[model samples]
Target: MSFAKEVKNELTQMQTEDCCTLACSYGLLLFSRAFSVSEISLLTEHSGVASLYCDAVALLSGYVADLQETPGGYSQVSVRDRQQRINIFEKLGLPVQSPRKQINLANLQNECCFGAFLRGAFLACGTVTDPTKDYHLEFSIPSAGLCEQFIKLFDEFDLSPRTTRRNGVSVVYFKNSTDIEDILAHMGASDTYMEFIGAKVIKDIRNQVNRKCNFENANAKRAVASAGAQRDAILYIQEKRGLDSLPKQLRELAQVRLDNPELSTAALLPLLSESLTKSGLHHRMKKIEQFAEELKNRSENEN
Candidate 1:
Protein backbone atom coordinates (compact mmCIF):
# COMPACT_ATOMS: atom_id res chain seq x y z
CA MET A 1 0.00 0.00 0.00
CA SER A 2 1.05 3.60 -0.45
CA PHE A 3 2.65 5.29 2.54
CA ALA A 4 -0.28 7.70 2.84
CA LYS A 5 -2.73 4.79 2.89
CA GLU A 6 -0.58 3.05 5.50
CA VAL A 7 -0.68 6.14 7.69
CA LYS A 8 -4.46 6.40 7.30
CA ASN A 9 -4.89 2.74 8.12
CA GLU A 10 -2.81 3.16 11.25
CA LEU A 11 -4.88 6.20 12.21
CA THR A 12 -8.18 4.37 11.63
CA GLN A 13 -7.12 1.61 14.00
CA MET A 14 -6.55 4.08 16.83
CA GLN A 15 -9.18 4.21 19.61
CA THR A 16 -10.32 7.66 20.60
CA GLU A 17 -12.20 8.92 23.65
CA ASP A 18 -15.84 9.98 23.26
CA CYS A 19 -15.01 13.65 23.13
CA CYS A 20 -12.13 13.15 20.72
CA THR A 21 -14.34 10.99 18.51
CA LEU A 22 -16.64 13.94 17.98
CA ALA A 23 -13.66 16.13 17.01
CA CYS A 24 -12.31 13.44 14.68
CA SER A 25 -15.69 13.03 12.98
CA TYR A 26 -15.93 16.77 12.62
CA GLY A 27 -12.53 16.90 10.92
CA LEU A 28 -13.40 14.03 8.58
CA LEU A 29 -16.68 15.55 7.50
CA LEU A 30 -15.49 19.13 7.21
CA PHE A 31 -12.53 18.22 5.02
CA SER A 32 -14.30 15.58 2.96
CA ARG A 33 -15.31 15.98 -0.69
CA ALA A 34 -18.73 17.39 0.25
CA PHE A 35 -19.99 18.26 3.73
CA SER A 36 -22.69 20.89 3.15
CA VAL A 37 -26.39 20.25 3.63
CA SER A 38 -26.87 19.38 -0.06
CA GLU A 39 -24.28 16.62 0.15
CA ILE A 40 -22.38 14.87 2.95
CA SER A 41 -19.86 12.61 1.25
CA LEU A 42 -16.30 11.28 1.42
CA LEU A 43 -14.59 9.90 -1.70
CA THR A 44 -11.36 8.00 -1.08
CA GLU A 45 -9.20 5.26 -2.50
CA HIS A 46 -8.63 3.86 0.99
CA SER A 47 -11.30 1.44 2.21
CA GLY A 48 -10.15 1.90 5.77
CA VAL A 49 -10.88 5.63 5.62
CA ALA A 50 -14.31 4.94 4.17
CA SER A 51 -15.05 2.44 6.92
CA LEU A 52 -13.81 4.87 9.52
CA TYR A 53 -16.07 7.58 8.10
CA CYS A 54 -19.11 5.32 8.30
CA ASP A 55 -18.24 4.27 11.84
CA ALA A 56 -17.74 7.86 12.94
CA VAL A 57 -21.10 8.86 11.45
CA ALA A 58 -22.84 5.92 13.06
CA LEU A 59 -21.25 6.52 16.42
CA LEU A 60 -21.83 10.29 16.51
CA SER A 61 -25.34 10.67 14.98
CA GLY A 62 -26.75 7.09 15.02
CA TYR A 63 -27.16 7.46 11.24
CA VAL A 64 -25.70 4.80 9.00
CA ALA A 65 -24.02 6.22 5.89
CA ASP A 66 -24.00 4.28 2.60
CA LEU A 67 -20.58 2.96 1.53
CA GLN A 68 -20.40 2.35 -2.22
CA GLU A 69 -17.58 1.18 -4.45
CA THR A 70 -17.49 3.25 -7.61
CA PRO A 71 -16.65 1.93 -11.09
CA GLY A 72 -13.30 3.74 -10.83
CA GLY A 73 -12.35 1.62 -7.80
CA TYR A 74 -12.98 4.34 -5.23
CA SER A 75 -14.81 3.93 -1.94
CA GLN A 76 -17.44 6.57 -1.40
CA VAL A 77 -19.29 6.91 1.90
CA SER A 78 -22.08 9.45 1.87
CA VAL A 79 -25.27 10.57 3.62
CA ARG A 80 -27.70 11.70 0.92
CA ASP A 81 -30.74 12.38 3.08
CA ARG A 82 -31.18 16.07 3.85
CA GLN A 83 -32.40 15.33 7.36
CA GLN A 84 -29.45 13.05 7.99
CA ARG A 85 -27.05 15.78 6.84
CA ILE A 86 -28.69 18.33 9.08
CA ASN A 87 -28.65 15.87 11.96
CA ILE A 88 -24.93 15.28 11.39
CA PHE A 89 -24.26 19.03 11.37
CA GLU A 90 -26.19 19.49 14.60
CA LYS A 91 -24.42 16.56 16.20
CA LEU A 92 -21.03 17.97 15.28
CA GLY A 93 -22.06 21.48 16.46
CA LEU A 94 -21.62 22.94 13.01
CA PRO A 95 -23.73 25.76 11.61
CA VAL A 96 -26.40 24.53 9.23
CA GLN A 97 -26.02 27.59 6.98
CA SER A 98 -22.73 29.25 7.47
CA PRO A 99 -21.30 31.87 5.08
CA ARG A 100 -18.23 29.66 4.72
CA LYS A 101 -17.24 26.34 6.21
CA GLN A 102 -14.55 26.66 8.87
CA ILE A 103 -13.19 24.54 11.68
CA ASN A 104 -15.23 24.59 14.89
CA LEU A 105 -12.62 24.97 17.60
CA ALA A 106 -15.27 24.07 20.17
CA ASN A 107 -15.48 20.61 18.64
CA LEU A 108 -11.87 19.98 19.75
CA GLN A 109 -12.43 19.68 23.48
CA ASN A 110 -8.78 19.39 24.53
CA GLU A 111 -5.19 19.45 23.23
CA CYS A 112 -5.34 15.72 22.46
CA CYS A 113 -8.52 16.25 20.46
CA PHE A 114 -6.58 18.56 18.12
CA GLY A 115 -4.35 15.70 17.08
CA ALA A 116 -7.36 13.42 16.68
CA PHE A 117 -9.07 16.02 14.53
CA LEU A 118 -5.99 16.33 12.34
CA ARG A 119 -5.85 12.56 12.00
CA GLY A 120 -9.43 12.50 10.76
CA ALA A 121 -8.78 15.34 8.36
CA PHE A 122 -5.80 13.47 6.97
CA LEU A 123 -7.87 10.35 6.47
CA ALA A 124 -10.47 12.43 4.67
CA CYS A 125 -8.42 14.61 2.31
CA GLY A 126 -4.70 14.25 3.01
CA THR A 127 -1.93 12.46 1.13
CA VAL A 128 1.79 11.91 1.75
CA THR A 129 4.40 11.12 -0.89
CA ASP A 130 6.63 8.10 -0.44
CA PRO A 131 9.38 9.20 1.89
CA THR A 132 11.94 7.28 -0.18
CA LYS A 133 11.24 9.59 -3.12
CA ASP A 134 10.16 12.81 -1.46
CA TYR A 135 8.99 14.45 1.76
CA HIS A 136 5.53 15.91 1.20
CA LEU A 137 2.28 15.77 3.17
CA GLU A 138 -0.75 17.83 2.27
CA PHE A 139 -4.45 18.27 2.91
CA SER A 140 -6.61 19.24 -0.04
CA ILE A 141 -9.53 21.15 1.39
CA PRO A 142 -12.42 22.41 -0.72
CA SER A 143 -13.11 25.50 1.31
CA ALA A 144 -10.56 28.36 1.46
CA GLY A 145 -11.75 29.32 4.93
CA LEU A 146 -11.27 25.80 6.21
CA CYS A 147 -7.76 25.64 4.78
CA GLU A 148 -6.78 28.82 6.61
CA GLN A 149 -8.22 27.41 9.81
CA PHE A 150 -6.23 24.24 9.31
CA ILE A 151 -3.03 26.25 8.93
CA LYS A 152 -3.71 28.09 12.17
CA LEU A 153 -4.44 24.81 13.90
CA PHE A 154 -1.12 23.42 12.69
CA ASP A 155 0.66 26.51 14.04
CA GLU A 156 -0.79 25.76 17.49
CA PHE A 157 1.15 22.48 17.42
CA ASP A 158 4.39 24.07 16.15
CA LEU A 159 3.93 22.70 12.65
CA SER A 160 4.48 25.02 9.70
CA PRO A 161 2.69 24.46 6.42
CA ARG A 162 2.46 26.37 3.17
CA THR A 163 -0.68 26.98 1.10
CA THR A 164 -1.51 26.98 -2.58
CA ARG A 165 -4.53 26.62 -4.84
CA ARG A 166 -4.84 23.57 -7.05
CA ASN A 167 -7.80 23.08 -9.39
CA GLY A 168 -10.03 25.27 -7.17
CA VAL A 169 -9.03 23.35 -4.05
CA SER A 170 -7.06 24.89 -1.23
CA VAL A 171 -3.97 22.78 -0.47
CA VAL A 172 -2.05 23.05 2.77
CA TYR A 173 1.26 21.23 2.43
CA PHE A 174 4.41 20.43 4.42
CA LYS A 175 7.61 19.72 2.49
CA ASN A 176 10.20 19.65 5.28
CA SER A 177 10.90 16.23 6.72
CA THR A 178 10.67 17.56 10.27
CA ASP A 179 7.20 18.97 9.64
CA ILE A 180 6.02 15.75 8.04
CA GLU A 181 7.50 13.74 10.91
CA ASP A 182 5.79 15.95 13.45
CA ILE A 183 2.43 15.59 11.67
CA LEU A 184 2.77 11.82 11.50
CA ALA A 185 3.69 11.65 15.18
CA HIS A 186 0.81 13.92 16.13
CA MET A 187 -1.62 11.67 14.28
CA GLY A 188 -0.30 8.70 16.28
CA ALA A 189 1.17 6.89 13.28
CA SER A 190 4.30 5.91 15.16
CA ASP A 191 5.20 3.11 12.78
CA THR A 192 4.93 5.20 9.63
CA TYR A 193 6.77 8.07 11.33
CA MET A 194 9.73 5.81 12.08
CA GLU A 195 9.68 4.46 8.55
CA PHE A 196 9.80 7.99 7.19
CA ILE A 197 12.72 8.87 9.41
CA GLY A 198 14.58 5.75 8.34
CA ALA A 199 14.12 6.55 4.67
CA LYS A 200 15.32 10.11 5.23
CA VAL A 201 18.40 8.96 7.12
CA ILE A 202 19.34 6.50 4.38
CA LYS A 203 18.90 9.13 1.70
CA ASP A 204 21.04 11.60 3.64
CA ILE A 205 23.84 9.07 4.11
CA ARG A 206 23.82 8.15 0.42
CA ASN A 207 24.09 11.80 -0.60
CA GLN A 208 26.97 12.38 1.76
CA VAL A 209 28.84 9.37 0.42
CA ASN A 210 28.33 10.55 -3.15
CA ARG A 211 29.65 14.02 -2.29
CA LYS A 212 32.74 12.60 -0.62
CA CYS A 213 33.47 10.34 -3.56
CA ASN A 214 33.17 13.25 -5.95
CA PHE A 215 35.53 15.35 -3.84
CA GLU A 216 38.17 12.61 -3.74
CA ASN A 217 37.79 11.95 -7.46
CA ALA A 218 38.31 15.66 -8.18
CA ASN A 219 41.42 15.76 -5.99
CA ALA A 220 42.86 12.68 -7.72
CA LYS A 221 42.33 14.23 -11.16
CA ARG A 222 44.00 17.48 -10.09
CA ALA A 223 46.97 15.60 -8.68
CA VAL A 224 47.39 13.63 -11.92
CA ALA A 225 47.26 16.85 -14.01
CA SER A 226 49.81 18.59 -11.80
CA ALA A 227 52.20 15.63 -11.99
CA GLY A 228 51.85 15.55 -15.81
CA ALA A 229 52.76 19.28 -16.09
CA GLN A 230 55.80 18.85 -13.82
CA ARG A 231 57.05 15.89 -15.92
CA ASP A 232 56.71 17.93 -19.13
CA ALA A 233 58.64 20.86 -17.59
CA ILE A 234 61.46 18.55 -16.39
CA LEU A 235 61.76 16.89 -19.84
CA TYR A 236 61.84 20.28 -21.58
CA ILE A 237 64.57 21.62 -19.28
CA GLN A 238 66.66 18.47 -19.74
CA GLU A 239 66.28 18.60 -23.53
CA LYS A 240 67.28 22.30 -23.82
CA ARG A 241 69.78 23.02 -21.02
CA GLY A 242 70.52 19.49 -19.69
CA LEU A 243 69.90 18.39 -16.02
CA ASP A 244 73.67 18.69 -15.23
CA SER A 245 73.55 22.47 -16.07
CA LEU A 246 70.81 23.11 -13.37
CA PRO A 247 71.72 24.20 -9.80
CA LYS A 248 72.22 21.29 -7.33
CA GLN A 249 68.73 21.67 -5.66
CA LEU A 250 66.90 22.07 -9.04
CA ARG A 251 68.98 19.27 -10.57
CA GLU A 252 68.18 16.87 -7.73
CA LEU A 253 64.46 17.74 -7.87
CA ALA A 254 64.48 17.37 -11.66
CA GLN A 255 65.99 13.87 -11.41
CA VAL A 256 63.41 12.94 -8.77
CA ARG A 257 60.57 14.03 -11.10
CA LEU A 258 62.04 12.03 -14.01
CA ASP A 259 62.38 8.84 -11.91
CA ASN A 260 59.13 9.10 -9.98
CA PRO A 261 56.89 10.53 -12.69
CA GLU A 262 53.84 8.78 -11.18
CA LEU A 263 54.19 10.43 -7.76
CA SER A 264 52.51 13.70 -6.72
CA THR A 265 54.73 16.52 -5.38
CA ALA A 266 53.89 15.57 -1.76
CA ALA A 267 54.76 11.91 -2.35
CA LEU A 268 58.15 12.86 -3.80
CA LEU A 269 59.10 14.74 -0.61
CA PRO A 270 59.92 11.53 1.27
CA LEU A 271 62.17 10.33 -1.57
CA LEU A 272 64.14 13.58 -1.71
CA SER A 273 67.76 13.59 -0.41
CA GLU A 274 67.14 16.74 1.69
CA SER A 275 64.17 17.09 4.01
CA LEU A 276 61.69 19.69 2.74
CA THR A 277 58.17 20.79 3.73
CA LYS A 278 55.38 20.59 1.15
CA SER A 279 55.55 24.34 0.53
CA GLY A 280 59.33 24.23 0.21
CA LEU A 281 59.04 21.41 -2.38
CA HIS A 282 56.38 23.39 -4.19
CA HIS A 283 58.64 26.50 -4.38
CA ARG A 284 61.54 24.52 -5.95
CA MET A 285 59.17 22.89 -8.48
CA LYS A 286 57.81 26.33 -9.44
CA LYS A 287 61.37 27.57 -10.09
CA ILE A 288 62.04 24.54 -12.36
CA GLU A 289 58.88 25.32 -14.44
CA GLN A 290 59.83 29.02 -14.60
CA PHE A 291 63.27 28.07 -16.01
CA ALA A 292 61.64 25.86 -18.65
CA GLU A 293 59.25 28.69 -19.56
CA GLU A 294 62.25 31.07 -20.00
CA LEU A 295 63.97 28.53 -22.31
CA LYS A 296 60.70 28.13 -24.35
CA ASN A 297 60.43 31.93 -24.70
CA ARG A 298 64.09 32.20 -25.84
CA SER A 299 63.61 29.35 -28.38
CA GLU A 300 60.42 30.97 -29.66
CA ASN A 301 62.22 34.32 -30.10
CA GLU A 302 65.09 32.66 -31.99
CA ASN A 303 62.77 30.69 -34.29
Candidate 2:
Protein backbone atom coordinates (compact mmCIF):
# COMPACT_ATOMS: atom_id res chain seq x y z
CA MET A 1 0.00 0.00 0.00
CA SER A 2 1.04 3.63 -0.44
CA PHE A 3 2.68 5.25 2.59
CA ALA A 4 -0.31 7.51 3.14
CA LYS A 5 -2.85 4.70 3.11
CA GLU A 6 -0.72 2.61 5.44
CA VAL A 7 -0.62 5.49 7.88
CA LYS A 8 -4.37 5.95 7.59
CA ASN A 9 -5.17 2.32 8.29
CA GLU A 10 -2.86 2.26 11.29
CA LEU A 11 -4.37 5.41 12.75
CA THR A 12 -7.97 4.30 12.18
CA GLN A 13 -7.34 1.45 14.56
CA MET A 14 -5.27 3.33 17.19
CA GLN A 15 -8.30 3.70 19.44
CA THR A 16 -9.07 1.46 22.43
CA GLU A 17 -11.18 1.75 25.59
CA ASP A 18 -8.44 3.76 27.28
CA CYS A 19 -8.03 6.11 24.32
CA CYS A 20 -9.19 9.74 24.66
CA THR A 21 -9.90 12.77 22.50
CA LEU A 22 -6.30 13.93 22.01
CA ALA A 23 -5.15 10.58 20.60
CA CYS A 24 -8.07 10.55 18.18
CA SER A 25 -7.20 13.96 16.78
CA TYR A 26 -3.54 13.11 16.26
CA GLY A 27 -4.58 9.91 14.52
CA LEU A 28 -6.90 11.83 12.20
CA LEU A 29 -4.29 14.34 11.09
CA LEU A 30 -1.76 11.58 10.54
CA PHE A 31 -4.30 9.59 8.54
CA SER A 32 -5.45 12.52 6.44
CA ARG A 33 -1.88 13.56 5.75
CA ALA A 34 -0.90 10.03 4.81
CA PHE A 35 -3.92 9.60 2.52
CA SER A 36 -3.25 13.00 0.97
CA VAL A 37 -6.55 14.53 1.98
CA SER A 38 -6.26 18.34 2.23
CA GLU A 39 -8.97 18.82 4.86
CA ILE A 40 -10.24 16.22 7.28
CA SER A 41 -13.65 15.62 5.74
CA LEU A 42 -14.15 12.67 8.07
CA LEU A 43 -14.24 15.02 11.05
CA THR A 44 -15.62 18.11 9.31
CA GLU A 45 -15.68 18.40 5.54
CA HIS A 46 -14.15 21.85 5.22
CA SER A 47 -13.08 23.44 1.92
CA GLY A 48 -9.47 22.82 2.99
CA VAL A 49 -10.10 19.16 2.14
CA ALA A 50 -10.34 20.22 -1.50
CA SER A 51 -7.45 22.71 -1.60
CA LEU A 52 -5.41 21.05 1.12
CA TYR A 53 -5.22 17.78 -0.78
CA CYS A 54 -2.11 19.28 -2.32
CA ASP A 55 -0.49 19.33 1.11
CA ALA A 56 -1.50 15.69 1.57
CA VAL A 57 0.68 14.86 -1.44
CA ALA A 58 3.63 15.12 0.88
CA LEU A 59 2.17 13.45 3.96
CA LEU A 60 4.94 10.85 3.89
CA SER A 61 7.50 13.44 2.90
CA GLY A 62 8.60 14.28 6.43
CA TYR A 63 9.17 10.60 7.20
CA VAL A 64 11.51 10.50 4.21
CA ALA A 65 13.39 13.45 5.67
CA ASP A 66 13.80 11.60 8.95
CA LEU A 67 15.40 8.59 7.21
CA GLN A 68 17.95 10.63 5.25
CA GLU A 69 19.26 12.49 8.29
CA THR A 70 19.75 9.70 10.80
CA PRO A 71 22.91 7.93 12.15
CA GLY A 72 23.93 11.55 12.34
CA GLY A 73 21.72 14.22 13.86
CA TYR A 74 18.37 14.67 12.11
CA SER A 75 16.67 17.80 10.84
CA GLN A 76 14.24 19.14 13.39
CA VAL A 77 10.56 19.38 12.53
CA SER A 78 9.58 22.70 10.97
CA VAL A 79 7.75 25.26 13.11
CA ARG A 80 4.70 25.25 10.83
CA ASP A 81 4.43 21.45 10.79
CA ARG A 82 4.87 21.31 14.55
CA GLN A 83 2.06 23.80 15.01
CA GLN A 84 -0.26 21.90 12.67
CA ARG A 85 0.25 18.66 14.61
CA ILE A 86 -0.29 20.54 17.83
CA ASN A 87 -3.55 21.82 16.45
CA ILE A 88 -4.69 18.28 15.80
CA PHE A 89 -3.87 17.27 19.40
CA GLU A 90 -5.67 20.30 20.76
CA LYS A 91 -8.76 19.45 18.79
CA LEU A 92 -8.73 15.93 20.20
CA GLY A 93 -7.71 16.98 23.74
CA LEU A 94 -5.30 14.10 24.50
CA PRO A 95 -4.62 13.36 28.17
CA VAL A 96 -0.88 14.02 28.18
CA GLN A 97 -1.22 17.74 27.59
CA SER A 98 -0.53 18.19 31.27
CA PRO A 99 1.81 21.16 31.82
CA ARG A 100 0.10 22.58 28.76
CA LYS A 101 -3.24 21.36 27.49
CA GLN A 102 -4.24 21.54 23.79
CA ILE A 103 -0.60 20.93 22.82
CA ASN A 104 0.25 17.54 21.28
CA LEU A 105 3.82 16.39 21.75
CA ALA A 106 3.85 13.89 18.89
CA ASN A 107 7.01 13.84 16.78
CA LEU A 108 9.04 15.10 19.74
CA GLN A 109 11.46 12.19 19.12
CA ASN A 110 11.73 10.20 15.87
CA GLU A 111 11.61 6.81 17.51
CA CYS A 112 8.77 7.39 19.92
CA CYS A 113 6.16 9.91 18.87
CA PHE A 114 2.86 8.00 18.50
CA GLY A 115 4.20 4.47 18.48
CA ALA A 116 6.63 2.59 16.21
CA PHE A 117 10.41 2.40 16.80
CA LEU A 118 13.68 1.01 15.33
CA ARG A 119 12.89 0.05 11.73
CA GLY A 120 11.00 3.34 11.42
CA ALA A 121 14.36 5.08 11.68
CA PHE A 122 15.49 3.41 8.45
CA LEU A 123 12.40 4.19 6.37
CA ALA A 124 13.23 5.86 3.06
CA CYS A 125 10.87 7.80 0.77
CA GLY A 126 7.84 5.45 0.79
CA THR A 127 5.56 4.40 3.61
CA VAL A 128 6.91 1.61 5.79
CA THR A 129 4.24 -1.11 5.83
CA ASP A 130 5.74 -2.95 8.78
CA PRO A 131 3.77 -0.73 11.17
CA THR A 132 6.13 -0.89 14.13
CA LYS A 133 4.68 -2.27 17.37
CA ASP A 134 6.32 -1.54 20.72
CA TYR A 135 7.23 -5.22 21.02
CA HIS A 136 9.78 -4.75 18.27
CA LEU A 137 11.18 -1.46 19.53
CA GLU A 138 14.62 -1.76 21.12
CA PHE A 139 17.28 0.77 22.11
CA SER A 140 20.91 0.85 23.27
CA ILE A 141 21.32 4.22 24.91
CA PRO A 142 24.89 5.49 25.25
CA SER A 143 23.97 6.93 28.62
CA ALA A 144 21.80 5.07 31.11
CA GLY A 145 20.86 8.28 32.94
CA LEU A 146 19.74 10.11 29.83
CA CYS A 147 17.74 7.07 28.73
CA GLU A 148 16.00 7.12 32.10
CA GLN A 149 14.42 10.46 31.21
CA PHE A 150 12.42 8.83 28.45
CA ILE A 151 11.68 5.80 30.63
CA LYS A 152 10.25 8.03 33.32
CA LEU A 153 8.17 9.92 30.80
CA PHE A 154 6.53 6.74 29.57
CA ASP A 155 6.17 5.30 33.06
CA GLU A 156 4.61 8.47 34.46
CA PHE A 157 2.05 8.39 31.69
CA ASP A 158 1.33 4.77 32.71
CA LEU A 159 3.08 3.49 29.61
CA SER A 160 5.81 0.86 29.88
CA PRO A 161 9.16 1.23 28.11
CA ARG A 162 12.03 -1.13 28.98
CA THR A 163 15.85 -0.80 28.99
CA THR A 164 18.66 -3.35 29.14
CA ARG A 165 22.37 -2.46 29.08
CA ARG A 166 24.56 -3.99 26.42
CA ASN A 167 28.21 -3.19 25.68
CA GLY A 168 28.64 0.35 26.97
CA VAL A 169 25.07 1.34 26.12
CA SER A 170 21.79 0.65 27.89
CA VAL A 171 19.44 -1.20 25.52
CA VAL A 172 15.81 -0.19 26.15
CA TYR A 173 12.89 -2.01 24.59
CA PHE A 174 9.35 -0.60 24.49
CA LYS A 175 7.62 -3.97 24.46
CA ASN A 176 3.99 -3.19 25.12
CA SER A 177 1.60 -2.45 22.28
CA THR A 178 -0.84 -0.94 24.79
CA ASP A 179 1.76 1.61 25.85
CA ILE A 180 2.42 2.43 22.21
CA GLU A 181 -1.26 3.13 21.62
CA ASP A 182 -1.54 5.08 24.87
CA ILE A 183 1.31 7.34 23.80
CA LEU A 184 -0.29 7.92 20.44
CA ALA A 185 -3.53 8.84 22.17
CA HIS A 186 -1.74 10.94 24.76
CA MET A 187 -0.20 13.00 21.96
CA GLY A 188 -3.59 13.98 20.56
CA ALA A 189 -2.68 11.90 17.55
CA SER A 190 -5.19 11.15 14.84
CA ASP A 191 -6.16 7.56 14.31
CA THR A 192 -4.79 8.13 10.81
CA TYR A 193 -1.24 9.33 11.46
CA MET A 194 2.24 8.06 10.50
CA GLU A 195 4.87 8.19 13.20
CA PHE A 196 8.61 8.21 12.56
CA ILE A 197 8.91 8.64 16.30
CA GLY A 198 9.89 4.98 16.13
CA ALA A 199 12.79 6.08 13.97
CA LYS A 200 14.04 8.52 16.57
CA VAL A 201 14.10 5.85 19.26
CA ILE A 202 15.91 3.44 17.00
CA LYS A 203 18.30 6.00 15.57
CA ASP A 204 18.94 7.41 19.00
CA ILE A 205 20.26 3.97 19.83
CA ARG A 206 21.85 2.95 16.51
CA ASN A 207 23.37 6.35 15.95
CA GLN A 208 25.19 5.84 19.20
CA VAL A 209 26.55 2.41 18.22
CA ASN A 210 26.51 3.10 14.50
CA ARG A 211 28.85 6.06 14.79
CA LYS A 212 31.27 3.50 16.17
CA CYS A 213 30.05 0.39 14.29
CA ASN A 214 27.92 0.68 11.18
CA PHE A 215 26.46 -2.05 8.92
CA GLU A 216 29.74 -1.63 7.03
CA ASN A 217 31.85 -2.47 10.08
CA ALA A 218 30.63 -6.10 10.05
CA ASN A 219 27.58 -5.22 12.16
CA ALA A 220 28.49 -5.40 15.82
CA LYS A 221 25.91 -7.79 17.26
CA ARG A 222 25.90 -9.50 20.62
CA ALA A 223 23.91 -12.60 21.38
CA VAL A 224 21.75 -12.61 24.53
CA ALA A 225 23.35 -15.92 25.54
CA SER A 226 26.70 -14.20 25.94
CA ALA A 227 25.24 -12.08 28.71
CA GLY A 228 24.78 -15.14 30.94
CA ALA A 229 28.35 -16.16 30.25
CA GLN A 230 29.62 -12.80 31.38
CA ARG A 231 27.40 -12.84 34.43
CA ASP A 232 28.59 -16.30 35.28
CA ALA A 233 32.14 -15.11 34.78
CA ILE A 234 31.65 -12.42 37.38
CA LEU A 235 29.93 -14.81 39.75
CA TYR A 236 32.61 -17.46 39.32
CA ILE A 237 35.38 -14.95 39.85
CA GLN A 238 33.69 -13.81 43.00
CA GLU A 239 33.22 -17.40 44.13
CA LYS A 240 36.59 -18.85 43.14
CA ARG A 241 38.91 -15.84 42.98
CA GLY A 242 37.18 -14.62 46.09
CA LEU A 243 35.93 -11.40 44.42
CA ASP A 244 37.12 -9.64 47.56
CA SER A 245 40.56 -11.22 47.58
CA LEU A 246 41.19 -10.78 43.84
CA PRO A 247 43.56 -7.84 43.62
CA LYS A 248 41.83 -4.49 43.26
CA GLN A 249 43.02 -4.42 39.65
CA LEU A 250 41.41 -7.80 38.83
CA ARG A 251 38.15 -6.99 40.55
CA GLU A 252 37.85 -3.53 39.05
CA LEU A 253 38.72 -4.76 35.57
CA ALA A 254 36.16 -7.55 35.74
CA GLN A 255 33.45 -5.25 36.98
CA VAL A 256 34.04 -2.72 34.24
CA ARG A 257 33.88 -5.34 31.49
CA LEU A 258 30.91 -7.23 32.89
CA ASP A 259 28.96 -4.12 33.72
CA ASN A 260 29.55 -2.56 30.31
CA PRO A 261 29.49 -5.64 28.10
CA GLU A 262 29.58 -3.56 24.96
CA LEU A 263 32.91 -1.93 25.74
CA SER A 264 35.76 -3.82 24.08
CA THR A 265 38.63 -5.21 26.11
CA ALA A 266 40.69 -2.32 24.75
CA ALA A 267 38.31 0.18 26.32
CA LEU A 268 38.85 -1.49 29.65
CA LEU A 269 42.65 -1.11 29.30
CA PRO A 270 42.69 2.47 30.50
CA LEU A 271 40.29 1.82 33.40
CA LEU A 272 42.98 -0.49 34.86
CA SER A 273 45.69 0.64 37.23
CA GLU A 274 48.70 2.56 35.89
CA SER A 275 50.89 -0.49 36.56
CA LEU A 276 48.83 -2.83 34.37
CA THR A 277 49.88 -3.69 30.80
CA LYS A 278 47.53 -4.90 28.02
CA SER A 279 48.99 -8.43 28.13
CA GLY A 280 48.77 -8.67 31.89
CA LEU A 281 45.28 -7.30 31.71
CA HIS A 282 44.29 -9.73 28.93
CA HIS A 283 45.71 -12.64 30.89
CA ARG A 284 43.49 -11.92 33.87
CA MET A 285 40.41 -11.48 31.63
CA LYS A 286 41.09 -14.84 29.97
CA LYS A 287 41.25 -16.60 33.31
CA ILE A 288 37.92 -15.21 34.33
CA GLU A 289 36.27 -16.17 31.03
CA GLN A 290 37.70 -19.69 31.11
CA PHE A 291 36.65 -20.24 34.65
CA ALA A 292 33.18 -18.93 33.91
CA GLU A 293 32.80 -21.26 30.94
CA GLU A 294 33.99 -24.19 33.02
CA LEU A 295 31.48 -23.40 35.70
CA LYS A 296 28.72 -23.18 33.10
CA ASN A 297 29.58 -26.61 31.77
CA ARG A 298 29.70 -28.10 35.25
CA SER A 299 26.38 -26.55 36.18
CA GLU A 300 24.74 -28.03 33.12
CA ASN A 301 26.15 -31.43 33.99
CA GLU A 302 24.73 -31.28 37.51
CA ASN A 303 21.36 -30.10 36.25
Listed per model in order, the count of residue pairs whose N, CA or C atoms clash below 3 Å is: 0, 40
List pairs with backbone clashes in candidate 1: none
How close is each model in CA RMSD to the real structure?
1.7, 21.7
Best by lDDT: 1
Per residue, candidate 2 scores C-alpha lDDT tens digits across 65-141 of 11122333432222135444444344344332331222234533332343432112111111222334223434444
* Tens-digit per-residue lDDT, 1-303, candidate 1: 888878888899988798788888888888888878788889999888899899888876688999999999999998968888888878777788851356778889998898889988998889999999998999998788777778888877887789999998889998999999999998889999999999999999999999999999999999999999998998998888898878999899999988997888899999889999999999999999998899999999999
Q: Could you give me the TM-score of model 1 versus the true structure? A: 0.94
Local distance difference test, each candidate = 0.88, 0.43
Strongest candidate by TM-score: 1
